[model samples]
Target: MLIDEVPERAVRRAGAAIELPEGLLVLDADSGEFGRMPKPVADAKIRGLSFDGARMVLVGGRGTCLLRLADGEQCWYGIPEERYDEHADLSPDGRTIAILTCDEENAIISLLDPETGRRRDIWSDPGTASHECEIRWSPAGRTIAATYMIWDDEMDDDALSTVVVDAADGRVLAGPFIRTHLLGGWLTADLLSFREEYDDLHRLQRLDTTTGEVITGPTIPGRVWAAVAGRHVHEVDELEDHHAEDTTFYTTDIGFADRRPLFTLQPKVEVRYFFLAAGVSLPPSR
Candidate 1:
């Protein structure tokens, strides 16, 4: 009897900070799929996400955590007093990290030097608080676009709005645009993105940071996740809404907004795995 040779396939280790429709789950993008990151720590309700194209930084509840894929490591960092976590983003060059902090009484923006783990108090607003939905920086890192929602206990409504802040002086440059969220925006020399409700199903809208004019995308259904730039094929899994305890992980597309069902990913069947090679050392940040 004789055996034939079979080629070996390489496995990639990956982890994802999944923003589920109802809850958030940090699952092993490779394997160990069912093992969910604890609910409370996962912050079932994540306001925003920022990826420097390498590590991912997650901000929610009262803390911010940094996660890496190659080694499967996580680091938790807390904000200063009177400053509750809201949303965060990385600077264009990826040297500094900015976070919005709210206290119920007012809102402020702070910047952290990731290399040194040092934070600087940048801007503060006494009259209002920031909307927790989204916060982003422009390509130059000179301006910030923040969505601000107003909470009215009497009317029982969350009114939508946005503000453009000058990073240098912390001054409101544009507005307080009223009644909007779920924006697909970008920061060039100019800032552009569409602002719309979940039901409106807005396409990518380009915005002018100086004039506040918008160029809209084609109308579509459902909410927009992230923007895709090129022709890279992606597998998506549209998972049904799940409660914190019952569900493990669901399927979704990588390029979901394109309206192209190009690929399908089954979490269990199609997966990746990471194993420690003998004598390999883990870094202190992990």
Candidate 2:
């Protein structure tokens, strides 16, 4: 039994779930063949993907391309070698796929028309001028909030700015507040949530979309992360050392009661991660 003869196994599969014309991609953790779906197309190593009504937008180490699943003949590519996510959202009734990729200077946000393979720059600064680090659109589809990390070569200092803007015209409406780690999205239509400085506390906080006032949420201890499930917020507070972690613990409150152990995750491989992808509906603030 030679070491080379042992088939190379993927320790993990990290990406978003996207649909093809045939069927939805299967993503079962700790499984066979590089988290590939039953379909033959899943065999292609992809970094990220999002399917709109007419086209499938894909981004990976190779490049960003759009494929028309009809006859498997339609395809287009422009931006190459970058990472994207659901952040590269395909609008419900539109033909544009907007995605963000990191260039040397700032986070380059662009929109791609899968049909023509035309890439349009929505917001991006020329190398090292001012980096648009990240952008997240409101679930309502009317506003966009982004983190702009600014660097000064003259003084050798760094500044962080967060802003909410009109998704359509790109008009700045909110604060360019000094913040990072946008933990939650659209707590209210006029509010956004983020995490405080990791050293002081691991807690959830909110920023007023209009006035840019800081509002505090629940405070959990020890490098914690949270996800909103229906009516409750679930928290994952990690134990001492994350590496070589066997059993991972998490907690959540069922009702207006005590927060108890929601569950424990056992990792078969050395490298492991716990991710929660959820969508919660929030009412507009009055």
Error at 254, model 2, angstroms = 14
| TM-scores for every candidate against the unseen true structure | 0.60, 0.56
* Tens-place lDDT digits, model 2, residues 147-239: 655664644666545666676665667655554555534444566766643326556667777676777766543333333331233323344
150: Cα error in model 2, Å: 2.9
Q: Estimate the overall C-alpha local distance difference test score of candidate 2.
A: 0.44
User: In the order shown, what is each candidate's alpha-carbon RMSD?
Assistant: 10.0, 9.1
Model 2 lDDT-worst window of ten: 277-286
- State the C-alpha lDDT per candidate: 0.48, 0.44
Q: Output the number of the TM-score-best candidate.
A: 1
Could you give me the TM-score of model 2 versus the true structure?
Answer: 0.56
- The digit string of per-residue lDDT tens for model 1 on 77-168 reads 67777667767766656676777666766666777777677887666654344443566776667887776566545557766566677887
